[model samples]
Target: MELAVDAKPTYEVGARKWLITITVITCAIMELIDTSIVNVAIRQISGNLGATVEETAWVITAYAISNIVIIPLTGFLGDVFGRKNYFTASVILFTVASFMCGFSGSIWTLVAWRFVQGIGGGALLATAQTVLVETFPPEELDKANGIFGAGIVMGPTLGPVLGGYLTDNYSWSWIFYVNIPVGIIAAILSWKFIKGGKKKLSGKIDYWGILALIAGVGSLQMVLEEGERKDWFSSNFIIFFFILAITGIILFIVRELTTKNPVIDLRVLRNRNVAVGSALRFAFGIAIYCSVFLYPVFVQSFLGWNATRTGLLILPSAFLTGMLMGVNGALIKKGISPRILLIFGFGMVITFAYILYRLATPAAGEWEFLWPQLVRGLGFGFIFVPAASLTLAGLKGKDIGQASGLSNMLQLLGGSVGIAALNTYITRRIAAHHADLMSNLSLYSQTSNERMQGIMLQLQANGKTGEQARQMAMGIMNGSLSTQSSILAYSEGFMMIGIICAIILPLVFLAKIKKGEIADIGGAH
Candidate 1:
């Protein structure tokens, strides 16, 4: 197998390019929406399928594992087959699988279909990115990327809200059913508008490398998605996969580095911008996904909001982000440095985290959180556009697809890691907070005595007998304290995220782009 570089294709923008862009973006949004849509429908799925809470979680995990495994391989597949043909086939596969998922009768059946759907859906993401990049000239790439970025940002933010509304108003199956119409439209548009790339034979396909990659990423994703539920490494199943992940990843890297025709071109990472951009992408993934996950859980569990209410609470941040993405896109076109935007984005996100840390309480209201979320949304707008543009700026045309695959893979992997870390951290924090709270609740303390007496009086007034009343009063007191302790734990978790983002801010200075470069790039548009 020998590596070859060939002449790059020229793209002309018109109706064809815009149509193709819309088709690919639609496909991309569908894929991303599926990733988070199930979060809100989990309870309904669990009850309807007669699965336990823990077992039902496999529905999400199975899809995620398959998605991560397939994303990196998308570039290889698109090259092997023609891009348009590959894109069409993926849509068909995803649509068919979604139908099956809706029709599934058992938990295992649904999980199986979700995994199949994920394999198809995963290609939609990186392939869509590559397609959009190549469809536009380098000059107009920022605007193209901006549109794609908006879809990426919007999908996860909208998923929980949409899913919640659908599940409450309709049924859980509607989640999958909703994709059918979107998929059909996208497929039709893709066939009509997408221009296929001329395929160059890059020697023999790296069979060994593909095997190692699947073994590595698939196992690692499974471990991350399920580890918290399985009690981390203590479970034999988790421990076994942990070993599999490490070994497979090591072998995959070695194989990629040594093989002439690697399934994924790990060598592209040698480009400095690509490498640093990938790291930042990873961090961005962590921050975004972890915040989405934690904020809903914190509000619902401690603030006692319903799914609909919690979903609505997040909408303001997302709306603010949408508005800022457009502004940032224009700013890039007007010769602004992305590094400055990146710093501002990071600062706003850290500020939002700090606000959450300080304001979260058992009795905290929606108004308390409104402004913080809006600030966080503004930060996300800053981070997404510039970070995305810079990541691919230095890569040659032939390497775009491979680089997109790798960067997207890191972002997905980072999300899984972030959620697992946040869940585990919150769990540990809850215990620590409870312990500290209990230490100050001795009966000898006047404050403790007064609280106990008040609770006892309330119970007696409710018509309980002496012995039963005292026990009920104690239970109520403990419940109140536990709720307060949980709030404290959540606050600490938010602070930790704030500190992590703050620490990463200095790295923005390391991103090297010449002054006036962005202006030159914009002027080319």
Candidate 2:
């Protein structure tokens, strides 16, 4: 249990370091779970608040956009305000916003509070890693990263399960309300025990970079979230924002590269491992994030499962993933090649996706998802921890903050993009399938005629007129057709995710990380 004599100490060593770790990890998990917890409650929110699905989506979109805008700014803000002060302040803001979000009577009111919550939430995510790396000795940073990766995987994995149980058993507001007590305890611990560090604040503010970042990231998020709603590029709304995304991104890059004090240092990507690791991270984001989003919606919408069942279906896999984090951490400490783990993880990911694709159906029960999801759980366990260690292995000091910010920001952006794109794909696929199925439905078709006749007779026997019975029968038929189309679309979507993940397999071998270099990082302190 003893650290080496010459190890660097950012705070008091031993007991306090572990306490600080627990405090920040608790807050980080709270913030992260909030990102996806509301997903299962969208229906309850819209019904209670009288908001349409489109209007209610803003609840999710607003939070996502805010996270994108604020994440990269965290390093800069931490330097201006002491890290502990900024971190403690963020916990207060997030907790208060959570309290307010639970009580909002209107959809827009909830959206506004969620946006504020995301601002605080984004800070916790960006700064918590910095604290972890600083808390442990340099060689033990991989162990720190293993612990940090647990929160990342667990938060999103458990969010829907917790959200579903709360929504079905209590009310949707409980999702937000649940954060209040936990947030208060975390804030108190973080403030009282965690040490604060202040940076020498002398750099000129990069206002242009800040502005460009806001415009670029904000516009890009808006485009992805709203593209399907507006019919994509066909709408003038989509076209205008596309221009802003491109122009703003260009300007942001130019400003950051030229500025004396950049808000986020883009130059970090020039490193070989950092650059390749980022792309793989982004791909990892799309794979895990998109599958989680798609699988739940598929079961809920087509299979007639309640929120609770849908959430529970994936619970085992997530827990398996969390348990594996420690397992991988042990492996990393043993100097096992991260490349081998990553390749194995990616292989499992491909396997998980393909299995899900093969097994997905309108009638899939919880048992059907059990094994595939477990494979996914194992796959993520290998993928997340090692991918993170490899990407961050080369960074030191201030660059760690900037790299962490950039890596975290890209993953968030990647998740949002994946959700948006997959949703759009499902929408289009459903429409096409629906049209194709409709073309085959006819009174002259024997199977269609008998099914319609049986439905019509049942409705008539229940006291409907002939015309009413006919209308009801058609309604039933159309509903069934829509469900079938949606189920097929989701299956294809899962297969597509598998293919995309498989394409990234080559990156595992190409990774610049050597086993010895990463091993030194673990014991170097």
Candidate 3:
């Protein structure tokens, strides 16, 4: 797989430059927001569409699978059709699909449209990042990345908020409808203003590579998304797909390495910075998204917070982190080592994790989560921008698209894998905790006997028969045991995640640190 290095060039400075930046980033954010936006609306959607909760989950799974599968292919698509045309086409596809998704009468129809939306949406992200990279000179890459990074950070954080509000105030369909106008505007701007990143006729398309990608990534994503509900390896569906995922991925890797004119270049991993940086990005994805996955469920499931309240609680901190991404970029350009920034970032994550572990309980209120969420946002701000800088620091012009695509793909998969693993961990831990707590609640303990006697006496005073009151007291104890077990499991999960961060911290020091550059960038034409 050979890279075609285009001569470095720059667009004329002025209104057009900033306009392109705004257009690309808006489209990027819009696509990203859709990724998580549907999460808060699943219950409403299932009820309205007359689908089972299990069936409605296909809407999310379809989008997620198609999105990750197409991400690494965006670079090749851009090279074939030209980035401007490909991007504009993507936006138009997403917009139309969103409209269709809103109006669909059946659950499968909505899921089909969602898959189409994901294809377009996936293209927008890495392609937009590459376009943003080409817009600025190398010296200003930090500022450029700052702008791009902000969108990535805000999109997921804002998704649940926007979705919750729309679903609560109007209807679930409005979530899809909301993207229509933004999509139209972004498509128009991209067609009229975006430039560069086009290539001449290339070798035969890597058809097998593409299929392998779909089979491998699609199957793996399915396994991750549905595994917990289906009981993992115990389910035949999970077992079949797990086998497909491993076999398909093995084939895909081999095909990419051996093919001339590969669908997505595998050779970029040869760069030390790019390789190490990609691993770090995957770790960061788990750290960021697992918390996002854990917090809402833990609060809603155990703490009894509503979806909207949980969304709002996480919002302020997410916004703070978005702003801090820009600052962290500038600091990198000012000679602060990315390694140092990463260490600080991981330290904050560990700190946030520790606090969350200690604070989580069934009786904990919303306010207890505030400062920890804030610190997490701050940590992400420090981590994201600098990591991007280090990843592509060694790549030539032709390699940027491929590197960006691969990096983004890894991040997405990491999040999926992390969410699945964390959930399974909590489930097993909860069972163990329940068993231990059950032992303590037995009549063998003096305190247990006293508590039961008190409950029985209180119930009897409320006019219940003695036997009925005793039975009710036992029920209350069982309920308390279950609740306490769940809370303990979540707390332990948080500490385990923190330990994982601490273990991966050494990778930051191993990443190559390149001095910031100020070279001109070529347009995507």
Candidate 4:
């Protein structure tokens, strides 16, 4: 069955176009916010449900597993059902799941609801992007990208802030409850404004491909999200998932390439721009998500900042990134090479990382981080629009949906890899630094003795006996050493991200993308 490609593609105009843009972008933001919003409430969630922190982490992991599993399938699903119906149904599903999540009495119940929410959330994100691209005419695609990019950058950043505010003032459940109103509005608007195309498939649905996708992507996502927690491959649980991920992914690729009607068209990668763009998007995901993950944890865990303060610290940079997205789009529209913008983006990211690396110390203040974060904002702003434009550039018809899904999948998977790898790296580095520091802490050395004496004297001055003071001095010294080790480990992690960006920087030139090419809506070909 076919939807004839010879027919003219229509785009929304005037207030209708903008309204459609707002509706899709809003849905995308709501999905993204929920991705990270639950993070800040983990402690509260654990306590309220009488679950260990480790058990409650499934609340996050379950959602992530379902999200990645569903993301790449959205394009295929959209084609099977009309895009409008699929998009609106996803919004309703997400809203209902969110409501159920708030009412969950146990950890596993909440996890189940979160998983369902992620299914809808993932569809919302991928379909929303496709909607935005199709809603604008080819010439104004850059502008559509700007609006969509703003939401992309703003969503995860806003999650923690919004979640922190609600959880602190109200309850942990409010984080899920908050999505109800936004999802309702988005669903209504989507149904009212979005157009649906009648699509008829010629063959049976790709049942094997769908199952393989779930096993492959779902298991892989679980590995990334839960690997460090499960102690990597040492844990049999991780090893089992790791095996499943490899086997499932292999079957998935083999089946997709051979199937008459693939769930996701792996053939999209045959296009050079899509291939290269997907790779760069992976790096982009790493840069953005890891920074968001690293900064908040650093401030709140080590710097002793509260949730609100940590979230606020990230606010300015996020806003700056949002503002710059439009400028990047305009520049692209004016015929600036996306490669140039891409390169500039990477350079700024490296600079931001370098600055933060230099400034990572136990005594570093909010002001020091503020400046580098602003530079990061500049990096993200420049990167977001250009990378997206380049990736989907020159694709038309069904390829657009396929490419969008693949690119989004790669980016999300990249974030998972970056976070998991960096978390493991930092943990190992802390132990190494602790050992190195401990080696120099010779009790026989004059410097060590002086330090010990000073600590003991301070303890005594605070009204302690010599024996008690000596033991207290040891504890204080150990704590100080641990803090310094952590600081060093974190500094190196920043550089690791910078090096990743630097490595991916050269791939920008490999793509055969034209200087000013923007994606054509379906039927343009």
**Candidates' TM-scores?**
0.95, 0.93, 0.96, 0.97
Candidate 3 residue 284 Cα shift, in angstroms, is: 1.1
CA lDDT, every prediction? 0.82, 0.83, 0.86, 0.88
In model 2, the worst 10-residue window by lDDT is 1-10
lDDT (Cα, 0-100) at 505 in candidate 3? 84
Q: Cα miss at 29, model 2 (Å)?
A: 1.1
What candidate 3 gets wrong by more than 4 Å, as runs, is 1-8, 517-525
TM-score of structure candidate 3? 0.96
Ranking according to lDDT, highest score first? 4, 3, 2, 1
Write the residue-wise lDDT of candidate 2 on 138-214 in tens digits.
66767788788888878887889899999999999999999999889889988998665555556667788999999
Please provide, for model 4 over 151-175, each residue's C-alpha lDDT reduced to its tens digit, 9 standing for 90 to 100: 8888888999999999989999999
Candidate 2's displacement at residue 132, Å, is 0.8
Error of 1 at 79 (Å): 0.3
List candidate 1 stretches off by more than 4 Å: 1-8, 515-525
Residues forming the 10-long window of minimal summed lDDT in candidate 1: 516-525
Pick the TM-score winner.
4
| lDDT of model number 3 | 0.86
lDDT of 3 at 456: 96
